[model samples]
Target: MKVLVVGSGGREHALLWKAAQSPLVTALYAAPGNPGMEALAERVPWDGDLEALAEFAEREGIDLTLVGPEAPLVEGIADRFLERGLLVFGPTQRAAMIEGSKAFAKTLMERYGIPTARYRTFRDPILALEYLEEVGAPVVVKDSGLAAGKGVTVAFDLHQAKQAVANILNRAEGGEVVIEEYLEGVEATVLALTDGKSILPLIPSQDHKRLLDGDQGPMTGGMGAVAPFPMDEATQKQVEEGILKPLIQGLRAEGVLYRGVVYAGLMLTREGPKVLEFNARFGDPEAQAVLPLLESDLVELALRVAEGRLEGARPVWKPMAAAAIVLASPGYPEAPRKGIPLRIPEPPEGVLVFHAGTRLGPQGLETSGGRVLNVVGLGKDLEEALGRAYAFIPQIGFPGAIYRKDIGKKALRR
Candidate 1:
């Protein structure tokens, strides 16, 4: 079957790479794909809109369309593709609003009795400030709409909380602000395949958002990640029953036949596992780390979900672990210096490089976005996986490249 993957990032590259391994996939294509994906997929030009993509899929006879980013799904890309009679794997606009709007997600959780932090929505900055004062320090402020993962502020004090609310409400988009009680604990990401009624959980992964080590520095889209986050079966079951099940039930209660990936950003607190956020599509660096361990054919699995046959779809996974380290350009998470030349060498066994922000330049592969590449390593154990990924980082010679040294240390400490 011919497949068209949407997006141009490390997550998309990883999806393309995994899709390339499926025997059911006859051909692979990517729209506005990065240079690294060119080896496996035929690069196609996109007009940078959902309508154009739907038309292209129809003209190209794309058997399946897999969305990688949240924006496209939130903007109703799947609805457009489905209206044109093209098979696409992504949630519709109504379903994706769980990620598109923080207020919507919080409301869903509150309505369905799903475990999550207590939150309040604010459209006026003055009201937000007053609420912050009432909630006091150690709170979280977030933009109700998407901000590419930079809208969140886990403020340690009242001053920082007010500043975050002011900054978010002051954006050009000018949207509402969501302030919530900060849940204390370690974080993990769990992505699942669903057809609205049925849910299939994938291996859990952990992502680091900070720019530097020791959890210091400003947040980024993602810096590094590790798969198989060492979550016990009991805790995983709690998260599935207490959160994911109710979430799907609520979406159905609202008349949405969702068909796509469901991403849960979890905070495993001393009380129990609670949701921090929900993403309609795949998690970027988490996908980079987790997809490598998937032994099932992605094309077939996604098609089954799109057809609403996910009840019996049993996707397989390897018993191995994976770690991914993202290399970013200079001044990333704020200002990234692009167009710098890159020197990447062929990796050894158990290591794979997925390009996130590079293009074919006059000299060679040059950095084009904030995150340049994702170096992933697979092994029998988490320690070996982390070691292999770090060992191969020095071969890449893109000067001013930034990366987190400790990708899987949190899980290792456990």
Candidate 2:
């Protein structure tokens, strides 16, 4: 079967890389894919047109189309393809509102009894600030609408909290904002495959969102990630039952046909696991780390989910651990410098390279976006995985490229 993977990022590259290993897939294509993906799949030129993509899928005899990013899913890419009777994996627009609108997600959680931080939505900045005064410091301020992953600010003080509120609403066209109490705990990601009915949870992974080491600096899409986060069985089970199950049941109760990966950004606090946010598709750097440890046939899994036939879809996972360290351009998650030459070598025996913001230019591969590449390492254990990944970081000559020195520090310490 021929398949099309959408988006251009490290996550998409990882998806295509895994899908290319499936013997069932006769051909592979990527829409607006990065140069790194060229080795595994044919790249298709696209202008981000949903309908046109559906038409292309129909024309190319693509058996299934799997989306890798949230923006297109929030814009109804899956719905568009379904409208053309083409099989696609992702949620419908209405279902995608869980990620598209923070305000909506908060309300849904409130209504469905999903464990989440205490929160309230505001349309007026003054009301938001007034609430800030009432709630005090150590809160999270968020743009109700999608702003990539940089939309959230975990403000430690009232001054920072108010500023976050003002910044989110002061966009060209003012927008809604959600202010919530910041839950203190370790954070981890749980991604599950669902047909809006049966839920199949994948291995939990942790992602580093801060741009600098030791969790300092602003939040980025993700700096790095490691699979099989060190969560006790009780906590891991709580995440699945307390968060994932209720999420799908709630969406179904709302009359939404949500079919795709359900990403739960969880804060595993003393009280229990509470959701920090929801994402419609797979997590970025997390995918780079987790997919490498998966032994199941991804193409077959996607096909079952797209067709809503996920009854006996038990995904198999390798016992190995995986780590992905992101190489970012200078000044990432703020102002990024572009066109810098990159010297990526043939990965060492155990490392895999996936590109995010890159282009094969006149001067060869150069940085094109904030996050440039994901260098993943697979090993017998998490420590070995991280060691292999860290040891190889310097060999890839990306001058001035920024990366976190402690990618798996959280799990290692635990």
Candidate 3:
């Protein structure tokens, strides 16, 4: 099967790399892919036009089009491809609103009796500010529209909450602001494959969203991740019953046929597992950490899901632990310092480097985005995997490069 994967992030790199391992994959292409994917796929330039992408897929006889980013999926890329009679792996526009709009997702969850944070949506900034004042401190302020994982703010005080609302309204693409009660708990991520009817969850992973260690500092896309998250069987069963199961039923109830990854950001509180948010695609560092443990052919699994036969196929995974630590440019999640030449050393066994925001410059490979690269490691246990992950950090060099020293520390301590 000829495959075309969309996006240029570390998640896309992992997907392309894993898909390349399948014997069924005859050819693989990445649209506007990063330099890290050069060895695994043929990179083609994209103009952010869905029609052009569909045409390219048709001309190249792409058997399956795997979308990696949420923006295109939210903008109806799957709809465009399906309209052209093309096989694509993603949800339609209306269904994708689960990630495209926070308010929509919250409302749908409420309608379906899905567990989530208590929230209110406001269109006017003034009303949002007033609501924040009423709600008081320690509430979460979120932009209803996508902001690349930076839109949500856990405000500790009323002033910060108002400022977050103001900031959302200040953006050109800003629309509504959702203020929700902050739930206290450890967060975990579940990336599930579904054919709009049944769902198959991958190994649970946890992402460290805060840029600094100890869960302090502002949030970027992700700082690091660990797969096969340390959750007991009871919690896992609770998540399946309280979250994943109801999610698929909710989508089916809405007459939505979702045929791709359903990334559920879950917060395990005393009450039970509550969804923090939903992403239509795989999480970045999470994908880097989790895909290495997949025992089945990624291409075959995706094709089966695209063909709506996921119920007939059984996916497998290796019983191993994996960890990924992200390397960020200076001033990441803000003004990232780009163009700094990168010097990477030879990695030892069990360690893999997945590029995220990097480009080939005239001098050499340079940092091109906030989160530049992911250093992943796999091992028999969480301790060994995390050790292997941290050991590679000293071998790399770049100006003002920042990364958390404690990536899987939470799980390791347990």
TM-score of each predicted structure versus truth: 0.99, 0.99, 0.98
Q: How far in Å is the alpha carbon of 195 misplaced in model 1?
A: 0.7
Per-residue lDDT value at 127 in model 3: 83
Checking candidate 3 for backbone clashes, the offending pairs are: none
Candidate 1: tens digits of C-alpha lDDT, residues 169-210: 877778799999989999999999999889999999999989
lDDT of 1: 0.92
* Pairs in clash, predicted candidate 2: none
Candidate 2 lDDT over 1-414, as tens digits, reads: 999999999999999999999999999999999999998889999999999999999998899999999999999999899988889889999999999998899899888888999999998989999999999988999888988899999998999998888887877888999998889999999999999888998999999999999999998999999998888889888888878888889888889978999899999888999999999999999999999999999999999999999988898899999999999999888888999999988888779999999998898989999999999998999999988898888999899999999899999988
Worst 10 residues of 2 by lDDT: 165-174
lDDT of 3 at 351: 94
lDDT for each residue of candidate 3 in 62-165, tens digit (9 for 90 to 100): 89989999999999999999988888888888888999999999998999888999999998887887787788989999989888988889999888888888
List candidate 3 stretches off by more than 4 Å: 172-174
The 10 consecutive residues of candidate 1 with the worst lDDT sum are 166-175
The models' CA-based lDDT, in order, is 0.92, 0.92, 0.90
